[model samples]
Target: MTIQVGDRIPSATLNVLKDGVQAITTDEIFNGRKVVLFSVPGAFTPTCSAKHLPGYVEKFGAFKDKGVEVACMAVNDAFVMKAWAKDQNVPEDLMMLADGNANLARALGLEMDATAFGMGLRSKRFALYADDGVVKALQVEAPGEFKVSSADAMLESLA
Candidate 1:
């Protein structure tokens, strides 16, 4: 089952492109912090590029004002994620988490099969408000749908 509110996020390793490839765990990112973690099916897909990811980037300051750490994750490798972030001009305040190999996605039960699309394993579009390792709110989009997981939607929910 997908993670629910009050559920503790699974400890999974995620690769990040710092100065170089660095491995970080879910606990290091989320434990003892209020985090707004959003996931996309793919990094540069149209919707994700145009709206999903941009929404969060645009609202980075707002989330920080609320004392929330903002992170975006995809099943792509670290290089792609770093490239995408640079291309999109992702601010330093926002984190680009690479869930290479779908470890984090599968651990969270949010992996989607997109082999037909030639993308193999990917993460479903979803967003969660996690506080100190415990989820406070979670939104998972239906396959091919985008309604409740946008940054504005998540912001309103935080209020």
Candidate 2:
């Protein structure tokens, strides 16, 4: 079933390029921390690169100010995520999570089929707020739409 408010984030490993491709666990990320984890369909895709990721990059500080750690997730490999991070000039603390196998997406029941677009299994464009591993809010966008999951919307939700 789709993860809902009050659900604990499931345990799963995700890749991040720091020093090398490091496997980090969901527990390590969400435990003891208030986090806003946002997912994009794929890294470097038009909407993801142009708007989705950029919004988070731009408002990262605001989240930090609110004591919320922000993470950007995509169903792409670690190398691609690292390259995209470099291209976007993402901040040091803004985590780039690589869900290469769509594990987290499946675990959350948020997987979307993008094979028609030439992209295989992917996660839907969504954002969830969690406090110490338990979800407090979630915003999922409709296909071909971007609204509720934007960084601005998340920031406003915190207000």
For every candidate in turn, the CA RMSD to the true structure comes to 0.7, 0.6
For 20-97, candidate 1 gives per-residue lDDT tens digits of: 999999999998999999999999999999999989988988999999999999999999999999989899878899
True-vs-predicted CA distance for residue 101, candidate 1, Å: 0.6
lDDT by residue (49-152, candidate 2, tens digit) is 99999999999999999999999999999999999999999998999999999999999999999999899999999999999999999999999999999999
Model 1 scores a C-alpha lDDT of 0.93
Candidate 2 global TM-score: 0.98
Assess every candidate by TM-score.
0.98, 0.98
The ten-residue window of minimal lDDT in model 1 covers: 86-95
| lDDT winner | 2
- RMSD in Å for candidate 2, one decimal? 0.6
CA lDDT of every candidate: 0.93, 0.95
Identify the runs in model 1 with alpha carbons over 4 angstroms from their true place. Answer: none
Candidate 2 wrong stretches, greater than 4 Å? none
Q: Considering only N, C-alpha and C atoms within 3 Å, which residue pairs clash in candidate 2? A: none
